[model samples]
Target chain A: AQTVTQSQPEMSVQEAETVTLSCTYDTSESDYYLFWYKQPPSRQMILVIRQEAYKQQNATENRFSVNFQKAAKSFSLKISDSQLGDAAMYFCAYMEGGTSYGKLTFGQGTILTVHP
Target chain B: EPEVTQTPSHQVTQMGQEVILRCVPISNHLYFYWYRQILGQKVEFLVSFYNNEISEKSEIFDDQFSVERPDGSNFTLKIRSTKLEDSAMYFCASRAFFGANVLTFGAGSRLTVL
Candidate 1:
């Protein structure tokens, strides 16, 4: 079984600044996918970004990016030029490659607060 | 972009009662899934359906729980006898046929068992 861990319980970042949320996972499989999802106060889960284990280059979506270290089993999310809307509960997820299609194991989650 | 939609945004029921949560996945999506998040807990996968049958299910999906795609667009999760522990937010998600597809989730239906 694969387990994702988000060590940071709560994080705060000033508007227009950058912040990073840490994530680590345990998986023996060589091929897998990692994702970061954001759940706002409304409780709607939204995809932030995703990274493929085979890719060496980190994935970036607008202001959201990830620092993926496969060897260390670490995948951290970085939000640049953060805005007030970035405040939410962020979750790190892991999915193993193979017959499994959409089964994602998620972390406990990190609450992000954007300060103006 | 098309998104998944769930009906009965909130449902209140008594223990031992039967409840069905309905969802309409994205039109073009081929894979559908159901997940639940207990208050203050991480979302947990319940079951995954593809090609009109269950492809995978978690231990949490016991005999009391079942999933069905009664029609082309509608996907449903039925609980035969609800319990207090069943109270949680149930989410319906869908993904396209392409490999390594990302899931699109609905707003979720909050189920409260009294």
Candidate 2:
């Protein structure tokens, strides 16, 4: 079974600054996917960014990016130019390749507070 | 952009009562999934449905829980007998295909079991 771990339960970043949320996972499979999801107080889970295990290059989407270290089994999310809207509970998730398909195992989550 | 939608944004039910959460996944998507997050907890995968049958399920999805795509657009998760522990936010998601692994999630349905 694959397990994703987000060590930080709470994090805070000043507006317009950068923040990084750590994530690590245990998986024996060579092929897999890592993801970061954001849940605002509104309770909607939104995909922040995703990284494919096979891709050595990290994934970046606007202010959201991932530092994916496959060898270390680490996939961390970096939010640059953070804004107040970025305040939310961030979750790290993992999905094993093959027949398991779309099933995801998620971490407990890191609550991010973007201070103005 | 297309997005998944879920009905009954909030549901309150008594313990031992049946509850059904409904979702309408993105059109043209082939894979559908259900996930739940307890208060202040991680989002846990419940079940995945594809090709009109269950592709995968987690330990949390016990005999008391079942999923059905009764029609083309509606996917439903039914709890035969709800328990207080069953209270959580249920989210429905869908992906265009498996290789991409990009899932679009709907605004969750908050279920409160009394």
Candidate 3:
């Protein structure tokens, strides 16, 4: 019933530069959660950051942050001071709130390449 | 930090054969989930288990698929008959409880069906 879309299939950035990955979703639920996950070459899905729909303030975790626009149903991730290790497949995921199970709907991941 | 562990990093099997993937969720976690991703595709939810029973499942989890917590620490996903299309990386995830939203995921088991 819910769908997440990552318009960009691939992205590249130079080391120490900043990059933003765009994500949008179609959902009818009012309360939900959003997350950004990074899968490096090792194929381990690591949580980058998270944001709650109820909170307008964006979430920031060290070098990873999110621009969450609840009304627009858009949540984008920003990586600052990108390192080569940041190169990975980035995924935007969504989950409904209010007594619902943590079933995640993920977007078509964007492959990020950070140059040294 | 506590992490979810999955076995058989990679497995190759023939069509119509049975395959079982195993995972060990975090000890303190109460919720467990199985998700899969075909090569170059987004991750898709397969099933969620809680209290030793499946709480929810997706359309992708058909009769051929089954999940079990045979012991206190291990959760397993069994495919009765593997198909070529079933080839994918299967991930096991767990969360602390109902109010905890973040689901920690394992490295995933890559299954190749020939």
Query: What digit string (tens of lDDT, one per residue) describes model 1 on residues B1-114?
Result: 799999889999999999999999999899999999999999999999999999999999999999999989999999999999999999999998859459999999999999
lDDT, candidate 2, A78-102, per-residue tens:
9999999999999999988878867
**DockQ value of candidate 3:** 0.87
Q: Which pairs of residues collide in model 2?
A: none
Segments in model 3 whose C-alpha atoms lie over 4 Å from true places: none
- What is the C-alpha interface RMSD of model 3? 0.9
lDDT of 3 by residue, B9-113 (tens): 999999999999999999999999999999889999999999989999999999999999998999999999999999999999999988999999999999999
lDDT for A38 in candidate 2 is: 91
Residue B76 error, candidate 2, Å: 0.3
List fnat per candidate, in order: 0.74, 0.91, 0.88
lDDT of each: 0.94, 0.93, 0.95
Q: Please provide, for model 1 over A1-116, each residue's C-alpha lDDT reduced to its tens digit, 9 standing for 90 to 100.
A: 88999999999999999999999999999989999999999999899999989999999999999999999999999999999999999999988787775888999999999999
Tell me how much of the true interface, by contacts, candidate 1 captures.
Answer: 0.74
Clashing pairs in 3: none
Q: Mark the 10 consecutive residues where model 2 chain B has the least summed lDDT.
A: B95-104
Runs of candidate 1 exceeding 4 Å displacement: none
TM-score attained by model 2: 0.98
Query: What's the CA error at residue B104 for candidate 2, in Å?
Result: 0.9
Q: Which model scores highest in DockQ?
A: 2
